[model samples]
Target: QQQVKQSPQSLIVQKGGISIINCAYENTAFDYFPWYQQFPGKGPALLIAIRPDVSEKKEGRFTISFNKSAKQFSLHIMDSQPGDSATYFCAATGNQGGKLIFGQGTELSVKP
Candidate 1:
């Protein structure tokens, strides 16, 4: 109930395409859901997030869709690009200051 598992350890897409990644958790106690994008040698930054109360959230070209009942969520990158190629991680925080749990990293490569 405290782990987030991500798929497709790596992905490749052409520029201007859509990149989709999925993650699921077993814990229902998780309240704060966040997706973080990280570039090489940089710390993960919060990209977009949603709570159990919300079904979906979007920010610019990034969108996070959450499924409370199924204990799952996903990240969709619109207009995939070479510059967008990087590692993305799905994370969760149960309460304030609760250590964020991260899914196995995903390497996304958008070919130019």
Candidate 2:
């Protein structure tokens, strides 16, 4: 299996603090990278993403920082909230195969 490595299996952040999760892949063919947020008993949904050509993308308090050469990316949540607690997954997809490769999920907790 093409593996995407993730760090800090779990993370704890205080409300209003920042939450960050990172992932790295070795596949050079992967072009699309997206971060998904999954709440308990719910399916994961796209949170933020960036192409290899872009260095960063931000929406609201969420940001995706990409490094093409390093084949790595990260998700940053500014001013995290208790409601932001969820499982985050980093995924990569290539055009040729159309398979989405996911990193080990990161569990984030925002303490009130």
> Which candidate wins on lDDT?
2
Q: lDDT for every model?
A: 0.90, 0.91
| Per-candidate clash tally | 1, 0
**Model 2, position 59: C-alpha lDDT score:** 99
Candidate 1 residues 14-66, lDDT tens each?
Answer: 99999999999998888988888899999998888889998888898998999
Q: Model 2 residue 80 lDDT?
A: 99
List the lowest-lDDT window of 10 residues for candidate 1. Answer: 91-100
Q: Against the correct fold, how does model 1 do in TM-score?
A: 0.95
| Cα error, candidate 1, residue 111 (Å) | 0.5
Residue ranges of candidate 1 with Cα displaced over 4 Å: none
